[model samples]
Target: MITDGAAMGRKSVGKEYPSHGSVLGGKPNRCVIHPLQSSMVAEALERRNKDWIVRTKDATDLIVQVGDFSFHLHKLAMVSKSGYLRRLAFAERSGEENGSSLKIILEDLPGGTKSFELVVSFCYGGKIDVTATNIAPLYCAATFLEMTEDLQQGNLISKTEAFLSYLMLSSWKDTFQILKSCESVSSWSKELLIVKRCSDAIAWKACIDPKAFATLEEDEAFCLTLLANSHGNLNVEESSEKWWFEDVSTLRIDHFVQVIESIKSRGMKSELVGSCIAHWTVKWFSRITSGFDNLTPKHLAQKLQRITIESLIKMLPMEKNSVSCNFLLHLLKLGLTKQINSEALSKLERRIAFMLEECSVQDLLVKNYGSKDTTYDVGIIIRVVKTYALFALKYSEPRVCIVGRLMDGYLPLIAKDTNLTVDDFKSLAEALPTNARYSDDNLYKAMDMYLLAHPNLTEEERTNVCGAMQYHRLSQDARQHVMKNDRLPLKIVREFMLLEQVKMARSITACESNDHPRTKTRTIMKVTKGLDRGCLTPKREISMIRKEVENMKMQLDQLQTCKVKLQRQVKRCIK
Candidate 1:
């Protein structure tokens, strides 16, 4: 119970309406006025009455003790401003009516008396001073009491905590300071649920406050603890990071799992615990596959643990283009490690096998070999092809053949691609397997284009492009053009001179061999003559000839495509 003896002290809040009829310092009421002057005095009294209902503290109902400070606040003012207070007021009304007490003790209230006083001010005048030091406590206290803004301003529900976090993200030093400070606050994620609310804010300021990571790095326990904390009433899709796990995997796995077990002993909602564990485990495994992006909301939901395999099957990518290869790899790892076992693991294996068979040949190449959009490391594309080629050698009729052809075809195009640098091509060369080298290697073609472009292969000051490709092999014509002296080998000169003698010997040998025709083999003959040669009358041979012609036409088309791509490379070199 609080004594009302502070009434006299409360009256000195501010300048008040001095006695209605008195002069300065309560001197006297002897001054008189005419009817016109009297009317003005009456109007002044009316104005004062209209304003004094809240200001005149003649009937304060509650004394809110915040730390060492006390606020003499109206019961209606506090109740209307806070849902928690309204409940307390209702419960205490009978006790107050029996004259027990008019005080509300806020034991260990967050934000101290000044911040609460600001709350009181807002209740009275709709204004409160907000600063970095006080803003956090103000928000936490408001959140604790479920205090909402005035509904007349159009807010439909009470969630001042989220709004406060949202506002905190806008400033530079403040956002970083708040994020670092809040991490050590103990059970903030489990109890306060600030992680999701502040995630985007933290990301935006990571650049501005590079040391923002120092807090988490110095305190590994804090990051792991955040992962294990159970959540409720969470907005699952609040973050749609294109690659969320890439950031989340910064947390240490062994320490994170240990922290999770400790928190689980204290009792967490099973669903939340399961979801957190599954997602974190998936992210941990994603690091090995280098496919953290495969675990984000773009591919899998956070609540995947709660969903059945049947639902997951529907959600999983049926086509190779849609396949989260890393995710399936994670499931297989989970099975082998016995992290997931029994029927679930069996089903997972089946799903993976089906995905492997149904996967798009083209898409699998892009996913593993590195495509332009998703792959960040320049050389991953090369290794992707190399690995695929290795996988093919084990099978006599291997699907790796598809990858093999693509590897050969894409090498020159990718090496000469304007998007990639010569250093990138060098990395590719380093990783490329020796056996996979011969087919359509672009290493030489790239240098040839460069040598041709500069006019004087000797003219340039040796760019990274020149330094990398200088020793690469080139064609006879390109070598002779200007880069190298035209020199014919002795063997080639001798062979050229003996061509007529070889032709005569081959003609005599052919005449002797054709003396006895064999029945085992079919020989093609050029049988056109004026009046001596006879034609082979058969539609079957005609069809075979057409088939050969068509095959040659297809080969010609592919050659033309390669020619066009080579031209584009040359243009890029000139540019």
Candidate 2:
């Protein structure tokens, strides 16, 4: 009696169909009476049943379904824009019986129709092979879909080399615009390298179109430096046969300085400063120092003085000797005669002192000033003595004396209390002849001898002597020697003496005070012993105890008064 109506309905249709009334419906036949109507019915059934055959629009759409989730043909095209899918076009679909489930059934299409199919496949959740035509579109589509894996695959397929080649071959304006769109540092660097390798400076200059040299940022500096170095020898000679030098004046020095300082501040390893300095120095040395013969004495003196001062202050200490000492000395003498500022003179004096302190004394005495034998000229001796005396008086005898007897004559000149004004010191210094010849050690010794003979000198005088002795190359032995003679007005020595006296007095007082504590302790112990021995009678103890008891009774009376007041308030509130 079972008519098997479902089987008859399927068999009578004369189309291969899914088993009728199976656990679930079998695969739906696309060739049913109305093909489109059948598909609509299948789709509706899929919604109702929660399961149905997935019929893709095309082979590519079918492939995407097997590998990735269902997607429209347009989406797949966008995802594979970098040509990644195109490269995988012939790849076999795994877990299939025929080894190839993505075979194209319809091969022929109208012109541009192939692209239309790809777009459709993409829209139908199908992945199209990425090709040059689809790359850009795919990138946009993948980015829109937020398909990170697809985007990464596209990037790999695109390759930096290919992109750079495209940039080089494409329109310069377009390439620059594209580069500007890159946001990440890595992407920018990659693009810049490509531009550097293929394009000329003009092209790169066009890209950034810098209006002024100062407009360069750190990244621009890196790019420009690379460009400049690649061009080779920025200071190359303009003329043939090496007749004319490179015209580096065209290179903006201010900009160069800015760039170098920026790089140095950022701790970069570029040698821009060094290269610029070397080049500029070579070009400007002659021009800067030209017309020496025409230079006025005033101008020459001023220029030399500035150079010497700058050299002394800024040049490495080790290189001071490399400078012309004679030139420095000549300028110093001129400065003195011209009555230049005392500060300048003071600096010159320090420089000379530094040089003398650094050099061997015997060399100065023998090589420059001649023999220090007893036959030494009186003029030399007098000049040496006077020079030392001026130095000692101006600063202090002790500071100069520390250098020895060569400065002894300077000691007697140190005033008792008043400091010699700069003008006074300068006048005294100018009066001193230039033939000073005493050794430094001898000067210190003589100063010490002079101080010892002048014990009545004031505190200021002693301080001046100590200051001079400590000034330059003064030996420790000489310092101690000057210190031993209280006649040398050294404030440190006097202060030290006063400090020692104060400390000693304090110690004596402390010792005396300590004796008082011991005495008091003995008295207390004796009294306690007398009490224990009953030498102190109970009557005396009772009187002392009664005093303590009376004090406690007064404290108790105050507390009772406070309690009475509190009770009165409580009784009134209860009422």
Candidate 3:
């Protein structure tokens, strides 16, 4: 009976259970097993008598140990099909301790223990159900065991080679399956050129229309596995040009990189390639951040993430806007967190700066998690904004204004954090040119929020913080708020007060100009129109004069309103 390596025991084979024979005649039939079904399959194999161990051990003359698994077999059964085993058997026979079983330890077997189990089964004339998932490792294990045709006809090496060729040429999904499977025995797969061949096949399929290839029944199962791996985020519909991305992204870094290089060599568009890199970053980094990879050690996972981000940066397309500005900012953020190389971080910063107008305030609000006494990574934003300001010189004024307002809107949010230093706040406020913001309402609001949060600022520091604001550009509402605010330094308040007086004086002069003598005379003539109709009685004249007096009183009330505004300004100035 067959069983897992972890539950090996002696059992007799029964004729009732049929073997899914080798790929020599026809493709093997096997169902994909879930973890629970894998155990079920093991139990079924045990009951059916396809033993992981040989049927009898009394005549066994050979023991092969791979990792924690041991296989007992007759020397004749093993030596006839394996050159390496034959040599080991001969060496054992020639030694002084020849009476004991010939023991061979494969410490670094290509596919580890389970794959070696398959090799042992093949040596015993058992069926080998080779599929895409096991093909690479099994082929490598067979190669390592030297199970070549020279040792026996229709041997493992020849059979697996044929299977590999057929699978690579059969369909798109099979080629990817082979490539992904190679990740288990990565170095050996590369050494045997399995990775290269599969990468080329995938690249060729990806470069042309995928409709040319057959979408066999197995591909549905393969796509479902990808969908599960990606947490149901991957769309594997044939209509999507990126149906292959989810499958390709499942590969480890080295294998994935090789496949990408192959695709690039086939002249795929840089934008599409960049998009793939972005997708991979989102998928894998989310895995790292979400803490789903519990099997991997923390430090090792971090190391892998660092490598992933660094490789992605190097793989980014040089074309402008190939990726969104938000993505570049995200990479820069992770790059900072991972402490990646400064050169790469610098590249991300510059790329972000080049497209800074596309960014929003929230995008730049990367929280500070370091020794810096700030609520956010204000320094990173400062650097990015400074670089963007320099780049803005060549662009249109509207674009510069966009970044300007983005920063303006960002300042108030960061200013509320008591830990944020005044210097960082001031640097961000003044990062753009004076003309970047056509109005300083938001900036003034930000300054007020900062001053309120940090009340211990020295007068000079307050002056420096307030210097970035242009009082004249402030909206009237902002101007009024500032005029009433007591947190502002006395010097700024006094300067703004002087400007307010000048503004009030200009307003009064304009009002007086509109009240010219001609206007007053016209108003009186309209009120006395009944006198011209010959109803010039004393009582009527008296009522007409009273109406003129009421008109004059209304004009006085308008002047009184202006006077009240001046008085309030004077009171604020005194404070």
Top-TM-score candidate index: 3
The candidate that achieves the highest lDDT relative to the unseen native structure: 3
Q: Write the per-residue lDDT of candidate 3 for residues 393-424, one digit (tens) a residue.
A: 78777878898888888898889888888788
Candidate 1 worst ten-residue window by lDDT? 31-40
TM-score of each: 0.28, 0.19, 0.65
Candidate 2 lDDT score relative to the true structure? 0.35
* Pairs of residues at least 3 apart in sequence or in different chains that clash in candidate 3: 1-49, 1-50, 1-51, 2-45, 2-50
RMSD of 2: 37.3
Quote model 3's TM-score: 0.65
lDDT tens digits, residue span 1-575, model 1: 11113101111111111122110111211101011111011111111321222344345567666655555557765676577777788887775787653677786555555556556655554333343334456556666566655422211113234334534554333433344434433243335644333444434432232234335554353223322332222333321111122232233432233334433444433443344445655655456458554656742532333233223333343334343544554444434433333555556555543344334434233222346432223343443434444444564443433443444444444443444554555555443334344333354455444334434322222243333322223343332232221122222222222332233333333433355554112211211111121363323333333344344335445656776788899999999
Error of 2 at 318 (Å): 25
Residue-wise C-alpha lDDT for candidate 2, range 430-490, written one tens digit per residue? 3332233223344455445545555665666545544433323445455334334445443
List candidate 3 segments past 4 Å from native. 1-58, 74-76, 86-97, 171-180, 205-239, 357-379, 387-402, 412-423, 433-442, 445-464, 470-487, 496-575
Give lDDT per model, in order: 0.40, 0.35, 0.69
Misplaced by over 4 Å in model 1 are 1-143, 146-320, 323-398, 414-423, 434-438, 441-447, 450-575
Q: By the lDDT metric, which is better: model 2 or model 3?
A: 3
- Please say which candidate is ahead in lDDT: 1 or 2: 1
